[model samples]
Every structure is written in C-alpha cells, then in structure tokens.
Target: MLSFPSRKHSSLRVALTALTTLAVAGGAAAIPTTSTATPNAAPKSWDETAYRGQVEVVRTPEGPADTEYLTGRVFVDQDRDSASDRRERGLDGVVVSNGRDVVTTDRHGRYRLPAYDNMTVFITQPAGYQVPVDESNVAQFHYNHLPEGSPELRYGGIAPTGPLPDAVNFPLVRSQLTRAQEQHCVIAGDLQTYDRTEVEYARQGAINDLAGRRDYQGCGTLFIGDVVGDDLSLYPDVKDLTSLTNGPARFLPGNHDLDFDSATAEHAFDTFRAQMAPAYYSYDVGDVHIVALNTVRYPCTPDVDNADGRRPECDDPENSPRYNGRLDENQLAWLEQDLAAVDDDKLVVVAGHIPLLTFADEGSAIHQVDQVREVYELLEGREAVSVAGHTHSIENMRTGDLVQGWQDLFGVEGLPFPHITAGAISGDWYSGELTENGYPVAVGRDGGRPGLLTLDIRGDSFRERYTVTGESDRVQTQLGINSPTYRDWYAERQAWNDNPEGAAPELGDPHVVIREDLAGQTWLTTNFWMGSTGSTVEVEIDGRRAGEATRTQEMRGEDQLIGPEWSDPHAVAQQLVHGGSVADRTMHLWRFELPADLGTGRHRAEVTATDAHGREYTDVLHFRVVDQP
Candidate 1:
C-alpha cells in the first residue's frame, strides 16, 4: 500500500500541468453534488469539488484580530435531506474539527476554531443521530478546505475553492443506528479490488454474504482501506460492491487508495475523498465512539540508515513508492481533544487501515504507527479497543500482549486494549480456486480463512467473533499435525515450485504420520482465528488429558520466529498447493508437542478453545502413527 512515485513534481508545476490538461480537455473538472434547499449563502463556483473546499462561513467573534477561528453549526435535519432547513434547529454538544483541533457546539449549536487552509472540517456523528450517505453508501460527514485545488494529479485531486464560505453546517437525521447500547458492528478489512473481475469476486464472496444477512443495519459495515489496488477508476466499481451491504456503508483511506502522481501530500488522498470517503472521520453509536483515522503517510522519507535490518540497501522513499504508517500532528491533537470531550466510561473504538501493532509485520517500522504510545496515552484509563487491516491476517491481540516493535520503535510494551486485524475480505488478493459460489478461497497469510469480524457490544463491553465466508460461527479452529513428513513435503514443494519446469508436488494423505515421525519434532498445531492472550487450547488424546498446548508467540516483547516449526501445517498444505500467501508464522497458532511413547494407531486430539471471556469451542483432528515404513 505504497504511493512513492518514480519522480517528484513541484506544486506550481503540478498546478500548471493540471490547468493545461483541463484546458485541452475543454472542461475544467466537474464534481458530484446533491440537491439541497436552504443551502448556505451562494456565490462561489458550484463545482462540487470546489464547493467542498470552501472554508466555513465568516464568524466575527467578540475576540481579538490575530485570533482567527473556524465557525460552524450542527442542526437536526427536520427533513431527511442533507441540507439544513430553517425549521431545523441547532443541536448542541455536537463536536466538530479542523483535523487536529476539536470543539463542541455552544448552546446555539455553533462552534468556532482558528481557521486554516488544507484542513478537513468535519462533525462527529452524535449518539441518536446518523450522518447522510451518498449513493455508494459512503458516509457524508466532512468538508475539505483548500484555497487552490491539488497540484498535477490523476483522479482529479480536489479543485480549488478560492475563498471561505458564508456558513458550513452539518445536518444529522434522527436515526436508530446510534441510539442504543446493544450493537453489532461490522468490520471488513482490505477489500483490495484490482479490477472488474476481482470486484465481481468481492460481490460473490463477502458482498453476497452480506447481502443475505439483515443484521447490523444500525451499527453498519465499515470497510477499512486498501479499498482498491491503485486504480482510482475502480472507485465506482468499489461503490457498486458496497451497495450490497444491508446497512449504511462507510470507508477509511488506505495507502493503496492514494493519488501517487500528486505533487504534495495534501493532495495525496484527494482522489479518495473525492470518490470514496474523507481522509478520516468519526461517528457514534450506542456507548461506542468510533474514531476512524487515516494512518497512512505516503512517500515516507526515511533516515540515512533505516532500522529495518531485514531490508538493507533499501532505496530512499522518494525513489520508491513506499508508504509509512503515521498520524499527522493535527490528527493527534484532534484525537486528544476528541477524547477529552468523550466520557471516560464510553468505549472508544479506533479504526484504521494500517495497524498500530501486529503479530504480523512486527519487524517493519513503517508497517506500524510511529506514535502508538501517544495514541495510547490519549486513551489512557478509558475502555477502548482498536481495529485495523493491511497485513491480510486476522489477529485478536488482547491487553498485555506485548509487541516487540512497539518497545523498540515507540518504547511501548504491552497492549493497553485489544488490537485486532479484522482480516481481509480479499483473502490474499482473491487468490486460489473458485468456490461453487464463484469466489476464490483466498486464505489469509496467518492461515485465517477469509472472513469478517463482528463486535457484539453491550454497553462499553463487547464480544468479538469471526465468521468465515460460507461457514457458521462454530468453525473457528483450523487443525493440523506438524510432522517430519509434512515438513519434508513443504521443503520439497517449495523447491519444485521455485522451478517452472519441475513437476507439481503432490500432498499425499495429510493426516498420516508414521511412528518415526513421532519423534519430539512432531506436534499438533491449531490456528484459532480469534485466539488471544487469556485464551487456552487443551488437547485430549482419545479422551485423555494430553495437556494444554503452548502458544507459538507469547507476545511478551520477544522476537518473532517463523518457518516450518511455526507454520500452520493445515493452512499451508492447501494454500501452497492452491494459491495464496504461505500459512507461515501467525499470532494465533497453538501447538501440543506429541509425546514419544504414544501408540501407533489412529488417535484423536479433542481441542477445547476457551477465550478470554470464557466462551468455549471444540474441534477435533485424527491422525495415524504407524510403524516406520
């Protein structure tokens, strides 16, 4: 999800190029706008792009000159239309922002802050209210303010506004979506559609699955980024797919959805805002406050010696199209204020495309946030949890689960709250064989089956569950036996796959292991999709206690270990033979080292997974231990 371009262009040069192209096309670009009565005092260009960039209308405070402040009002839409009506009165206590600065509406429902250019002005959706959505089901909650439109860019970066507007008002419709404490929040990660074909795959897969389900109409489904694979034109296709959701659909920008050809970072996500969503925004439902952050920073300039020992001789960010995960100073400041306004008892659900810390990509500095500790500090003592995607793995990392990268890069040790990677719907970019439903079985990198994560919330507390595509909730564990024969087959398959001329490696009986294979090297592995710190996996051999299995990664600030020993044999056996990321090391794999004295007969290990919340699930696996053949 990088946007590092081959070359850099100056802002002026970018502007000139845009102007020339528009002139040649015989039309300056056009933006989409909805019809609204009782709109603000009209005077400027009606172009939706330019209109969206207009500064909030003038507000002459009874204060000083150097103290310029932004002004806005939040009103209840008496009529369901998006515009504010005269009969519609102001709604007090509604929070608004200029990216970093946060302010609440006064008694009259008006807010003011120091105004600035290139700032995204938005209103946080209050409890008992819902923001409007465009035809694509994208939430409408913010306005972009820029004096001049984007520099030379593809996907038509925002057109210039030239000046501030007379007034900027947000209208909220009374909705059941945000009024209750009980909620089902839908979280889908990494749609990552590459083209029309993949778009159809999404439709048949998660989209179709979502279509049949009538749940989550209130909390709605939020698609965390990597919405598309670098192609801005596919935005319409992306929207078409989103229409399948039974509830309101919203989006967050990912690195992949950037205008890489843009001249400045300011215009980087302009196309995303233009087509899919705001750079970032927030909304409220029940006791949970969802703060969606734009954590992707493009063209991330690295120091002379990058800390990534894994990738030495790395090219400069300017020379490569890499992106770093970071929250801008403004967003961070805004977050502090936003949190300050919220009651500590309220559950804060922070969502972003890139994770703050992950069991996957622990060594790469750019993959995780640079200021995770700061975010943690802002939410300190508050009941909170985070959701992210980008690693294409499902991880349910709970509090006290240490991330070594956080300690090394940000000096953070244990997770303050649960951090989950919702797992990508694209499922390894829609890799592997097509199912009868006309979709691929794109298993995830950590061997998690492609699925959507749902948060069943009551008050500030919640229970998280992952529902695999085309499967029921009971299918949570993936069972496999890690044996010498399988490991040998793994190595041999890799060697053959590396050569185009080599014959295909066949995976014989997957559940068969000989007595010789039972040396201390063999073990029973289980990839529990929703497994976390307090979770336990107990193995019973033919109804007897074989003892609790040890988790592969303790997540206690230790280094990550990968390879055959850490791999999910069940996932790899199929993923490698089909097509998908290898089921290598994962955060959820638990193994029970097989005893050397077991009998040489087909035996069953009953695994009972008990989560941190005490909910339990059972799964079984059968394997044979014949005499050495």
Candidate 2:
C-alpha cells in the first residue's frame, strides 16, 4: 500500500527550510518567499498589516435628479477604513467597467458610465494597488445594481437596490505584495460541494492546505469555477471555506452554480452574482492581467449552424432549456474592449468556467466555447495563458498541441498558447472511498488526484505546478504496471458491469508478471499528473542505464487514445473496487515496455520524471516475475 505522510500542519519556517533543502538537492526550485517590502524585490511573507475592507457607497440627496449615469471614485484608503474620506485623493487612469462599457478614472479618480436596470459595476484592480477584501478575504471591488430585484426564484436572487446611487466609490491600498515580480497564483477548480458534509471534506482537504500556506497572499486564490454543486444554498458554507484561507479569494461561476429555476438566460446566475462575484470580470497583479470570463450560456440558442451536427439541445430554450459552453454577445463585446485597453507587454490570463478549448471535451461542442476562434483572434500575438475548470481532469496542454476533435469541432489545428484544465477540487464529485484525512480519494478520470494549480510567475513567463490535496508537492506522479493479467481483468470487469453477475473475479498480484505475460507485452506506466509535451519520464531497472519512456498520447494532431488499453491501473483498481470514475485515456501518461526476456524474481525499477519546467521527481516500483502462477 502507498504510504502517505500524516496530515499535520507544518510551521512556515520548517516548511521553507525543507523546501530549500530539497531545492539544493536538485529538486524543483523552492517556492519564492513572500514579503511586503519593495516592488522590485521578491516577497518574504504575507502582508499581515495590509488594510482589509469593502467599497464606499455614497448616498444621494433626497431630490428627483438625473439618473442617466452612474459615478464612482477610486481612492487610496489612508485611514484603513472602507469609506473614502475628504482628505484622501483619488487615483487616476485606473480602469473601471459597468459590465459592458469600459472606462478609466479621470485625474480626480472619478469615473462615469451609462446607467442600467440590472448591472454590476467593478474596477480592474491595477497592479501595485490591492483592493479591499471583505471579512472572508473575498476581494470587494464591485457594486451590484438591480433596481427591481430578481424574478421569483427558489434561492433568493439579488435584492432590490431601489435606485442607482449618486456615487459608488472603490477603496484601494498600496501593497508591495501585489507589486512583486515573483508571484504564486492559486487556481482552484470545481469545489462542487453538494451539502454540508462535502463542505467539511473540503475544509479538511484543500482548504486546510491553503490555510497553512502564506505564499499566495499577493496574487491570491482565484477559484476558476463550480464553487458549489447544483445547490446554490451551499454558497455560504463555501464562503466559510475561503475565510480560512490566508489570501484574497476570488471566484468564477460554473455550470453547476447556476439557478436552474431562472426563466431566461439573462437571470440564470442572478443568485450567484448576488452572493459570489460578477458573472465575469478582470483584475491585475504585477504585470499579469487576469480576464475572468463568464463562458456558460444558459437556455442557449443555436449560435452556429447545424452543419457540424452538434448541440441539437440548444435549438429550444423555453420548453427544454440547457446550459452550454458559450459566451453571450455582450460578454464578447466587453472582452474586445477589455483586451484593447491592456498593454501588449502585459501577460494576459484568460480564465473562465468553461475552457475556450480543452483536451478532455475537445470533441463536445457543448463543453467547449462556441466562439473559440474569435477569442484566439482577439488574443493573437500577445503573451497569453488560458485556464478553465469544468471537466474534472488536469490537462497541461502547451502551445502547438493539437487534437483531432478540436479540428473536427472548431476547425482549429493547434493551441496558440498554453491552456490548462485545472483539476477539480471535488474530484469526480467526491466519489470513491474516504482517505485517513476524512475526504474521498476521488481520483479524476485522467488519474489525477484532487488538487489545485499554482502558476509561479516571473514577469511575463510562468511555470505551472499541481499540489494534490492532503499530499506534498513531491507526489507528482502515480506508478503502476499494466500486464496481460490486468488487461484481461479489465475486460472481464467491463463485461460483467454490462451484465450483472453473481460476483466479479478480482485480479490478483497487479505488480506481478509471468513469463507468458511478459511475452505478450507488459509496460511500466507513469501517470504524471501535470506532465506536458516538454515533460519527460525515464526508467532505470536494476541500476542499468536509464531509457526514456514513451508518452502514450503524443498530442500531435491525433485523436484521443481511450479505453482499457490506455487506463491507469492504480487508479482503476481503486475506482472499480471502491467507487469513482474509471482512470482511462489521459494526455499525460507515459509507458516503458518491460523486457520479455527477464529472469524470474523480484525486480525494482527507479523512475524519474522531469516536468516542462525542468522540475525533477523520482518514484520507485517493485514487481515480481515468475514462471507460473
């Protein structure tokens, strides 16, 4: 059995020291320490002294006046209060928006935009200046305006704001933490908690991990989507999870976080916007401009012709409404305006609930953005990285990576830049047996463990890393042997599952291979969770010279390699025996063929994996070979 370390908290000093030792010993470079000292210097610690509050909403005089426009001011919070004071001066040239029109603050730090009935007005948090955060460490930079309130719904939507305010001012504080060149930004995927029980499971797993770490307080944690399951009532409990985090918590709405009771596409996420964040928004930290897009279209109508023979469900909305991976026209228009304002030198981080394109659902028209080419054209010739979370799998697809499904569905050949499907926090919807930490194993369909993705950024360049929940950063890969016996058992299990039988025969000795099995063909498979095209895996048997292992899916204009032959044996074993999605078909799996002519006995293979970022990790596997059973 695999032995996991205890789930006890480690002091920051101890953790850093251990990490430094590992770095010196030729492991991945130690995570850059955080500090609140200088903009050019690397951070040393969390900015504990930073002011935390919300936006300042100015009340108007009692008189019938012009309500054609909404106004706001962006100012430095001198007294640490959330409100804007008389002496405090407004900061100029900051970008602000009213969900559609993009504008910038004048010399007086004031901005004006056309008024609307139901709109969300927010600021694109400028680099070197941190916005105020609420009690739960959620960044408070937006003002929701719904004069008439939401329509009748099961979960309470936005309450009535009565009338638009005279001024809705935003507060900011100077933060060296946000100004630092080096940043560790956390991108957490589906924390799709269905009930209070799942909330506790999250609390004990990834939540606990974030609470203990202080390195990401600057760029902070951006939960990329699916904050909760279908039940929007659990949003408060999810907020409780964020309260335990050391950084500012931001969110993007997912398909599951929708209000199914809504009658139209416009009000589908009213409740989510009321409780969480805007359906879509953008912010800046250092040189990175993060554009969080609302990519889920509810009650979606067919935007593209049926020539591709996809998304037939999108034909009707009133009687049979369904959500699809698409951006509305308004959002698209706003995206164009948003990108126009950003400087070409800045790195653009395009984040959304549904991916612009993904390897997991590359073939599904409903699971990928409908207007993907438009987005690519808009971001053409600029440093960009796309991150999304809908498919509960981890995919680190780099630039030029191609798949047949993308070409067939979207008429796209290869990726323009890196695109990552950050694995789900509620791994496979929290399926499988519980671990010692009181959470489900819930291994992903791609054999990736439940985890969070961290983008360690320096200037316009970044390196991605995945930290499995309740495990150390070193646990990057899962090793197993795929022999003839396991293959036979996989077929047997699939057939038995199709037709219920008295009992299913369990495959014995998964780590053992007989002479005949070796002759038939056996492979040592490595499931490198975050491995990408540039990553490499090598195996050394009995201290012999190491030979490079071949990646199963080369991702060079090829279709998905699926089914039992390409499955992860270790993950499949748990999934079939206990519960969870089967581990089959992944872009990151690598295999090394075992020699057919080998002496029968115990054998040990030392495997080493070097990631795209050149971070090295090592694992060992021991298996036995015999002449007979």
Candidate 3:
C-alpha cells in the first residue's frame, strides 16, 4: 500500500472571468469566400466585442475541408419566446468552443468557429447566465449537430442533424433560487454521444430539466463520466446543455475519457485533461473533502526484459489492458499527498467512474485493482466513503469479504474497504423515446427508476437519498431473487418472445415461492444497492430490535457457478440467474432462534437497513410463532 505524509496543499483559486479567448486555427485555413463576401456583409475584423456566448470547433482526422465548426448565440429571453427574436440581442463576451479551441462571443453575443463532424460546441456560461447540471452533476450545453438518421456506432442513440440551422441558439432566463432548485442537481451517464444527432439527443434529453429553476443557488453540478460515448469531440455540445442549467457544473473522467489519438500513458488521458481537469483531484465543500480519482488506464506497449520486476506487465503497456486497472507512481504519490493534507477527521468522500468493488463480471479483466485494497487501507478508520459509477447498474454491496469470492481472477483476496457503485443516472443508455425534458426515461438492470444519489454529509455521518424519476426518495433494498427454479423458465420465456422456434425448455412450476427455512441458523446477505462499509442491517423480531448485523466481509470475486449442487430441474431453474442464494447455511449471516416468549397470533417484525451514507430502509416480515403440535 502506498501512503503520503500529511501536509497542507494550497487552496484552489476561484475562477474569476468566465470568458476565455476564442480559439482560432492552429494552422490557418483559407478564409471561406462565403464569410469574406460583401463590404457590409461580414462584421468588421471579427468584431470581438458584440459577441456574448461561446463557440467551439475541432479539426478532424480529415483535412481542413472536412473540418467542422459549431457556432452559437446565447440570447437573453426578455419576452421569453425560447427563440431569439430580431430585437433580442445575443449576450456578449460569453466563452465558447470545445475545451481546446475556445472562443468568446462577440459584442453581438454571436460566435462561430470551425469544428469537426460529431464534435461538441458550447459556451463557458458567463456569471449571469447559469449552466445546467445533470443528475450526475454533468453540465448542459450545445453540440454542433444532430443528424436525422442514425450514425454508425456501437451505442446508437443521438438524434439526427438537419441542415445547419441559421444559428444554434442558447437562451437564458433571468435567475431565481427556489428551494427545490436551491439544492438541485442533474445526473447523466455515458452521454457517449458518438455523432452529432446523439449530441442533440443528449441536448433534448437534458435541457428541459434546466428551465426556470433557482434552488441550486449556483453551487454548480458534477457529471461523472463516459461523457460523449467514446467521441471526445462532442464535449462542447455537452457543455452547451449545461448552459440551460441554473447552477455551476463540474465533471469527473471515466474509462471513456481517453484520447485514442495518443498511444501511451503520457498522452493517454491528455485529451481528457485538456478537455476537463486533472484526472484525479479534489475540492472542498462544507466540511467535506470530495476526492475524485482517475482509475482508468490507456494500455501501453510491452517493456523490454520486464525490467521493474514489479509485475511483468507493469512495464508493458500492451499487457496493461489485460489487467484493466491503474494509478501511476505519480498519482499514487499525489493521492497520498492529497490525503495527507486533509484534516484526518474531515469527512472525505471519494468519487470515481469505476467502482472499487462490484458484482458485475468480477473476475473479468475490467474490474478495479488488487492495489485498490491498499488505497482503502490507507483510509482505514477515517470518516470516509467511496462512490463510483460506470457499471451502468444499481448495486449497493455494503459488506461481505470484498475479495473473498472473486479475487482469484485477479489473484487478490480480503476486504479492502467500503465502496458504492452509485449506478448510472442515465440508466441503460437513456433507453426510451425522448421526453420533453430533453432526456429519456432510462432505467437500470433491476428496473429501478432513473435517478441520482444526493449526499447530505453532516460531520462523520451522512444521509444519502436515491431520487428516482417521477418518484421521491425511493430506495430498493432487496433485488428480489429473479428465482432459481425459473432460470430455465425465464430463459424459455425470453427465447419464446424472441423466436418461437428457438424456444427454451418448457416453463416449470415457476410460481412456487421459496421461503427461508431459517431453523435458527440460516444467514441472509442483502445487497442494498450502494451500501458502503459502515452501513448496518438490523433485525427486529415482533417489533423489538433483535440485533445489529456487523459488516465483516467484502463481495469482490469471480462467480462460483456451483450451488447446492442444485441438479433438480425445477430448483436449478429458479436459482439460475437470480444471483442471490443461500451459502454455507451457517457462516457470516445469522439465523437465530425465535424467543419462545413471543406468543404469536400474527407477528410483524421489520428489518431496518442503515447505510454508511445514512440512508435508512425498512421492510416487514409477517409470521406466526405458534406452539408445535
């Protein structure tokens, strides 16, 4: 495990002027004859002053002719038409452009630039005009195009782009801070907008949420990544969506935040750093140290002779991908140094795009590292909790031998720390038709509502709430077994629906429910999605607190396909895909004898679950404690 000696780093400087110089050609392109037309045609010498918003453009792999540019005009909605009327003037000096080729709006608030196809174009948002933040703290802004038809990409979803409109306009309303808006936040997952239309889809799916809100008080928002699918150019339009927001917006990088342009670690995240911030960094907010870590790696080439002896692949960039985890010497050192400076007792919340521990393909090369255990060990006994996204599923594995079941794949074992897979706010790639809010009603693997997690950290203890779409403070504790016996039944059902000829085996007695025959010795392990290490599961018998369960194990390992050697056709079918089952029937979880004194007619007892984030959930079980005949 790496460690940093404690020390204080300088406080981060607050941003002053929002406007940054507009980026011009790196290597000049011939001034377009259309732009250079009549004497009165073009504004004199790039007027630099009348402009008020932002514009970003990128040079694609193609030569200059094929290059694309996205220009935008941000207007003040004096009459609230949503569109800029002739009399309405555009905002001036607004910062615009993709992160790299930035430019400011002129005195006319009109800005234009050369960008590439599928590139993002947006504004930096002047102080007066608030930007939007998605549920994951991503900002709302403009992208250059949304092609009408689908483009060729692995994840197809962006809306199509029509003829370049006269101007991609952004409108801002006067700001007010309403209570609900005061603490408002927007969450988005791998907007992964591969093309212009997808960028537009992202725009449509997210912009409506920003209309006329005030509560955020401009605290801003944070977007956990997989931002523009894999296309880094779309970041600008991603920025534009934030312009509609009522607060400041921030971002954290995910695996997708890479520069395919570069081939080594040095340039691996260079594109991301150029577009966002240092991969892993932190900020302070009301007694909390929010530390974000960059855990992804750009696989490198093999090293000669496996020189370092640290690991044969550490030296070989080519071998890194097979490992799928990273934190370089610099980052590891910086992390220790970063943690060293914080007051030991200050509440620290670490955020990353990939989870430290997860149930999805645990043994797969894509999971977090064995070294992560050391990172967790460093935070031992500290008032800390780690949060992450990227799995695209909602899972709260609070405890149970982090590496116990799945470590062998990575050659690791043991509980490292408390981690939470915050689940994607976009929910299965925003799966559905677009909503008026400019987003889709994307839900997750478990059919839970699409939402985000909000943490109200009060000292060492924090309260977290998962706000679902169209639902308030909804939390799901039980995944509710998909049923082992119905494994083949569900398979058949799915197959039949897909293709009758290829139908799976007949559905057995799929309706029979199985209850725990906890003859006082059975243990139940519940994964309250997003549960962290310090969280607790309490049992109540007959409305009385039976005992508080200790979180002693971690759930990180490869799947063990063998069950109770379940060969019975009906039984095996039910347990097949549920992923939940009885284990050992004796260890870790506990089943205790019901107190004989509990004279039972109809007894109702509740199970209370409290997470490290302070979110509580209660479920009641009804039964009768009657005398045996």
Candidate 4:
C-alpha cells in the first residue's frame, strides 16, 4: 500500500482575475470559444484491468490556434456565490492543481493551466476557508474539464463542456467551526452497498446513527473508499445516505468502486470522480488538516515466485480485476507541498482506502502499503495518524508495534504513528443474518461489529473510538470459549455450512460448559476487537482471582497462528453458518485456561480489558460447570 493519493498527468496553477455571475451548485458559465481540435474519443473496448502501459492514451491534434488555456481565480468570496466578482478579493498563496502539476495562486487570485481533453482542475481548500456544497452536501471544489462527456459510461459521467470557460472560480466562506482546534472527524470505511436494497440497509445502519448526531458537521464525514461495489449507478444512493449526516460528506474510491471498463489507470476513477468525489484531496477543519487519499491500484501485477515463504518477490494483485495498495508520483509531491505549508502545531489526519500497515493479514505483501516509510518520513515530526479500510477487519496498531510482515515486505521497522484499519461500514460486505433493525450483523473478520470510526480531536491530540452499527460504543469485545464440544460443533458446522448438503446442525448452549469439558482442554476466549500489543485481559472466576489471559499474536516478528485453536468460538458459532468472513485467528484474542477443579455449579467469569491507553472496560459471562453429559 502506498500512503499518498492518485496522480494524473494534467494540472496548472496560474493567476488571473475575472468577474462573472455563477450558476447554482457552484458551477459557472463557459468561456466563449470554438475548439479547433478534433474529438478525443474513448475506445470501443478498453480494459482498465490491464497494467498502466497496456492501455493506449489516445489524443487528437490541437491546432496552434486551437490551444486552450484554463483560467481560474482563487478569491475570498465575500458573498458565498460560486463566482468571483469585483467585490471579492483574489486570495494569494492558495494552491491549485490541474490534476498533476500544482501551483499557487498569484496576487490576482487567477490561474491558467494548459487544459487537456479530460482533466479536473481543483484547489486545495486553504485552512480557515470553507468550500461550497451541493444538494447532497458533497463539497463542490473542482471544475470537471471534459469538453465532451464520457462515452459508453454507466453512471452518467461528467457532462460535456461545449468549450473551455473563460475562467473557473472557487468560493470560500469563513466559519468558526473550522477554526477550532477541537474537531470531531468521522471516518467511515467501505459503505460498499452493491445495490438499492443494500443502500436502504445502510440508511438504517450507520446513516441512522449519523442523522440524530451533531458533532461532525465541521470536520465532516469522510467515506474512506469503497463507496460502491462495481455499480457506479449506486453513487446517488450513497449520496442520499450521506445527506443524513449533519456534516459535509467526502469520498475516496476503492478497488470495487472502479470503472473497470475504462481503458487506462488515468480514467479508472472517472465515473467515481463524476459521481461520488475527487480521487484524492485535502481539506482542513480547525487545527486538523485531513489528507484523504486514493490508494488502490487495480489489477495489480502478480508475483508467482514467492509461494509459501521461501521468500523473494511480493507483487501479487490476486489475479485479474483485483487490486493492490499503491499510489502514483504526483500525489506524493502534492502531499509534500501541502504538508510544508501547515504549521507544526496543527494535527494531520491522513486517510485512504487501503492501509499503510495493519495487524490483520500482517504477512500479506498486498495488504500493507509498499511506501509506508516514505509516508512516515514525510510526517516525521508532525502528530499524525492513518486510517483505512479494505481489509474488512479492525486493527488499532500503535507506534512501535512490530510485525515481521512489515519488516520483511517493506523494510519497515515499526509504525511511526497509529495506523488504524477502520473496520468497514460494509462489514464483511454486509454479510451475516439480518438484524432486528433490518441490516446485516456483518461481523468483520477479526470479529469487529459493523461500525463507524470517530476521531475526537482536541488541538493536536485525539482519541479514536468505534461505534458498532445499531449498538452503542460499549460493545467492544466478544466473549467465547473453546472446548471439546465447541471444537466439535465448530468443525461440524463449518463443514455443513460450506457444503450445505444436510440440515444445519444447531450448536448447543455455547456459553455453558461442564467440569469434564474444563478438564479436557476447555479455554475461555475474549476477542477484544480493538486490542493491540499493550492491551491486557484478566479474568476473575466466581469471586476468585484467575490469572491474566495471554494475548495471541504478540506482534513481534512472528508468523500467523490460525485455525480453530485461535478462533473466537462465539463468532464461529454464527459465522460458520452465516455468510460473513470467518473469525478464525485474531491478534486481539485472549485465552484464559479454565480450571479443571471447579465445582459442579454455575460460575461467572468477570473479564476486564485494558486498552493500550489505560482505559479499561469490563464484561461478565456466565457458564455452568455441570456433571451432565
């Protein structure tokens, strides 16, 4: 995974000032001109899944007289109109881009870039300035420069621009909400609703949770990639879902949200750019500057050499149509410039679709960023953290948490900052049985419940919390046990569930255990969904102090210990039969050895989990130690 966003070949930052009345939705009238170039058309058949070079970049000849120069001004919109007027002062030092090369606005607040057939000219909404939002509350900060709209596109790609406008201007409104150091930024992972029906499920799930709340209206809600599942048409439904939020909604594209039919990597996210949001962008709210990135490179090159760890080469993109975590060069340069402008006192929050590194699937080369150290170096002295989706798991990796996978794959020693996998809102791709609220249980691979991540920011410091969909924040850990009966049920159910050849066998009372079972290798398990290396779990059985349970996956350069032994049996009880990803091995599982000498009776085990930050949460589970069969 690469830490930066995406890069396009087109971008210009020049300064010019022009006055014109803007239209609704922050769009402007076209500059009167006739194009002297032939039409630049999309191919009849373009394979977006192929490597970058495989697809051809088709362009038409631009006559010397037909050359287009894009003109735009960055002005302080005294009136929040979408256009620049005499009354508005052109803001100096604001950065703008033609999609690739970046430039700052001149004293006149005007910029001119060599316009391409298809490009998106946008500004890096400067700190203390707010951008305009359309009907769905998506920030309208860029001008789509497609002279002729998309061809053979599904999601109604950018509308055809008859000609290049005389100027494209940006508007900004000043707000105290964005100036405060304390900000509540909501980072929602993979709202990947495949169709209309799942869209409604989302409406009832996290969207419902956001509607009645009022915290994140300033820093806003960022849907960190996977906005849809291959269906570009569903972008509207995703937008409608965002309308429920009290804040502005932003988006990033994921592998599944790609325009796979597009011929080249440059236009792979065109439909998404047209419908959902920019491929990548940065905005600031209060003392926090958020750098939202697009990190998925589809149809990644596969490496067949390093099978089963004899170790050499690591470029597996998982066959055709799959993707890996990566970023192009342009974004990295823009990021450097963006960060250089910010004061050291400000907090930086970097978000992307794919994580730079994660505890789940730690050893998989494709699961973590290939350029994590570069990102770490970029933010060397700044207080920053990264949050991402795509793994369908929740991981709260703190600084200094080491895994051999990162060391081996990317030569990364340890994390430079907290790297959190936000645990997709489309948990397990919206799997499992439907809840009473009409949404799926969607338990994640690490057994994290479907939820949203909130970063409670105060100046440069922040606290992160996950609120499970349809459940309160208190639902942090899942309790389970391992015994002969549990293991037997686990094996039997997984088999029948996979094949479905017979009536599914029901698991007996999962929370209950017998003295005989305890004698025969019964162990209590606590799956602390967000637990990390420093976290601890302890148990008190029936008023007596039991020893502390040891955490699995010590995260110190060790290989994965998977299978039934490390599984969360409570999750397996449902997952083996349901549709979600199985919760087999977890980095946060704590196993307590059950005492073989316990008397035959009902016993209560009090479980306490202490997070890396010293915050403790407790829960109790009751199980019987009976003499029954």
Candidate 3 lDDT by residue in tens digits, 1-629: 11113434344322212223342210011121111111111122211211223222222344234225555577775665455676888787555554234455667777666644433455544433444333323434555344452333223334454544445666654433211111222333445566777666555544443333333333344566676677777777777766565455567777676765444554455455544544565544444556667766656333522233433444545433423455656567656545554556556677777666555445444455435666876676566766777766655544344544345544446544345555555555666545566656554443333455555443344544454443324343432222333343554554554565653465433322233222332222333444555656776766586676543333434353322211122212332322222221111121223344555355554556665544466654454433331
Residue 147 of model 1 has an lDDT of 69
Which ranking of candidates, highest lDDT first? 2, 1, 4, 3
Q: Candidate 2: RMSD over Cα atoms?
A: 9.3
| Model 1 TM-score on a 0 to 1 scale | 0.85
Model 2 stretches with alpha carbons more than 4 Å out? 1-47, 63-65, 303-309
| lDDT tens per residue, model 4, 472-538 | 5566677888888888877888888778886887777887786678878888888887788788888
Q: Which candidate ranks first by TM-score, i.e. highest? A: 2
User: If ranked by TM-score, best first, what sequence of candidates would result?
Assistant: 2, 1, 4, 3
- The residue-by-residue lDDT of candidate 1 on 339-423, one tens digit each, is 7667656778999999988879987777888778889888887789999999999999998888677677667778899999999
Predicted candidate 2 versus true structure: per-residue lDDT over 526-596, tens digit per residue: 99888999999999988888999999999899999998779888888777777778888999999999988
TM-score of 4: 0.84
CA lDDT, every model vs. true structure: 0.76, 0.83, 0.48, 0.72
Model 1 collision count: 10
